[model samples]
Target: MMREILINLPIESHEVPNLRELVGWDGRHSDYPTLFERCNFWAGLRVEKNNELIAFGYVAGMGLQHGYMEDIIVHPQYQKKGIGQSLVKKLLQESERVGLEIVTLTYDSKHASFYNESGFKPCSGGLWRKKD
Candidate 1:
């Protein structure tokens, strides 16, 4: 049977828990509501098999000139199925449509080839996290 994969669907605040769980991120679900509300641009994909959310991802950013892609994840069982690539491409398209000059994302070194294949080049930058 063919599954249904919806791209760039409207994201509801209730979906945040599933997204965080899929990516194995530890954070308060409450934090996502406000964060998503403030995003300049965002896109989400939902891969549904019999109405279940099997795979998902999204990119959120703050500025018109530079957009950051985030939480691009395909469920462990669904990796290597091109879902991540499609999700990223969808967000990039949206970013460009909104006049964004650059779309940026950070990923682990192990995933470099995937992003490279998706047309991302190695670039230098720095990151600093605030102490909590």
Candidate 2:
């Protein structure tokens, strides 16, 4: 079965946990809707056969000139198939379409090659440590 990519669609509230599980990230943040709904963009990868969400990623930056991409992950079974790259490209495309000047994301050093291949360059700058 082929896979399809759906961009900028409102994510149903029920699927938040599954989306979080894709990367095995922090699960303690129980208030997912508050955060997810506030995002400017969301990209979901789904199976064409059943419309099941297999991967997800999003951006947060006031939907303005700057965007910080986060939570980019693909299902374990779906990794190495370029799905993540596709999501990243779609996110970049949509953000640029809105006239965003720059897009940035943080990733593990081990994934440097992926970000580099995706047209991202490292820039030294201030770190986020406190809330505004």
Model 2 ranges off by over 4 Å: 129-132
Looking at model 1, residue 104 earns an lDDT score of: 83
| Model 2 residue 51 distance off true place after TM-score fit, in angstroms | 2.3
lDDT measured at residue 119 in model 2 versus the true structure, 0 to 100? 85
Root-mean-square deviation of every model: 2.5, 2.6
Give the alpha carbon lDDT tens digit for every residue of 1-132 in model 1. 325445445666657567567668653578666766666655554555454454555556666588777767666666787877876777777778788888888889999999998889999999899999
Clashes of each: 0, 0
The lDDT per prediction is 0.68, 0.79
Question: After TM-score superposition, what is the CA distance of residue 130 in candidate 1 from its true location, in Å?
Answer: 1.7
Candidate 2, pairs of clashing residues: none
lDDT of 2 by residue, 1-132 (tens): 656677865566656567676568655356567767688877887777877777788888877689899888787888898988998999888889878889898878899999998889988776677787
TM-score of candidate 1 to 2 decimals: 0.80
Itemize residue pairs with steric clashes in candidate 1: none
Determine the backbone clash count of candidate 1. Answer: 0
Q: How accurate is candidate 1 locally (lDDT)?
A: 0.68
Candidate 1 lDDT at 90 equals 73
